[model samples]
Target: MAQDPPAQDLMHYESMAQDALRGVVKAALKKAAAPEGLPGAHHFYITFKTEAPGVSGPDDLLSKYPDEMTIVLQHRYWDLAPGETFFSVTLHFGGQPKRLSVPYSAVTRFYDPSVQFLLQFEAPAGEAAASAAEAAAPSPPPAAPSAGEGEAKIVSLDQFRKK
Candidate 1:
């Protein structure tokens, strides 16, 4: 017989915690990106996927780092704008200014060395991330990999919807 209804969901709790932590990062970025600016020794080191969804940056600079890149937001940056889902800033490289826009979801680590605080996140997965991973990986010919080749069938929810 089935036991009493399960009471606690550990994964749900963990997801909530993760969201709250992400919010903290957003808040910190907002503060540091503000006009008042970094408020006395506060700076950020944000590391994120270069190929992840919603991440846009100078092609030359991004190509130098194929997978991940870390940016320090301390000085010599401009137009630091933090949006609801992403942030953009202008930074100097090789004596030239370059701009980058990164989605918060793509960020893997956020740190403040001055305060010795750190937050880390798992690699985010999405259409772009999945596509990027697929492009980077080698695959057999399309004809060689068929659904009947031990692959699970993909269900289309559209089949259940009214036309």
Candidate 2:
């Protein structure tokens, strides 16, 4: 006989872990917020939900990227401040500077292309629950390459060689 899994998660471990990961993002932002500003070729690409609560941005930017927006904190950005619940920064859009405030909960992805480090979070609760069915739909496995379609080879030359 096998034991059954618990139907309810009393400890809420997943949410706790998620919060912990968000904390890492916060810590990294705090480092970037310092005067040195993104040490030695290090930069970040942060993606967030535009409609999430506590997200503040210019009207044009919000309208332009209504669903999601990705911002690069590289050489041109200014005033990268990480706060208790949110981080605010000034970034240039189309030669104009705009300040944006996004709560950590709204952020879904954090990446540093220089070091190739990345952290991705699940979508906000409302969006996730709304699209649960679509997300749950299973897709068929990808088809294998026929011949020399990719870097890896399936057949060996020795298999056809005379003995």
Candidate 3:
């Protein structure tokens, strides 16, 4: 007897959920940009793919964090502009200021340690496969860390996945 094909996510619920969550990020940033600024000790740690499409930063910064990088947005940041699909901000690195533009789709993780809130996003299907393949290749030399680079709290999604 022939077996049926495995189930597929034709409804694209995952994409929808991710988009909605990104909206949450945008809204929070918008609120932070307000005159009052972030309220009650709220801060953010945004980790994103450096090489993802629509991401822009200094060449040195990109080379240092070729794959992924985390930025802390607590203090000493300015021009926190949020757009329809991307957000731009100016941050200091090594005593020099640099600007970065990151697309919401490029964000892999968002965390607010003050509130213990976290959101982890999976790479789109195609990119996930490509990233897995890239992982098999040899990596370049490790680069020095920039300012405000801190240890990231890792959370696995295996627990939420269906076996």
**Best-performing candidate as measured by TM-score:** 3
Better of 1 and 2 by lDDT: 2
- CA RMSD (A), model 1: 15.6
Candidate 2, residues 1-163, lDDT tens digits: the string is 9999868988988888988999999999999988877899997878787888889988876876665677777677688889888999887565567899999999888877788787878777787774466459854332322322212111212222247
State model 1's lDDT.
Answer: 0.72
Better of 2 and 3 by TM-score: 3
Q: lDDT for every model? A: 0.72, 0.75, 0.77
Model 1 Cα lDDT, one tens digit per residue, 1-163: 9899888896787667766788888898889787788877877778778888888988997886666777777766789898888889887665567889998888877877678777877677564566467769866422211123222221222222246
Over 4 Å off in model 3, which ranges? Answer: 1-7, 134-163
Lowest summed lDDT across 10 adjacent residues in model 1 is found at 149-158
The candidate with the higher lDDT, 1 or 3, is 3
Question: Clash pairs of candidate 2?
Answer: none
Worst 10 residues of 3 by lDDT: 150-159
Residue 88 in candidate 3, Cα distance off native in Å: 0.3
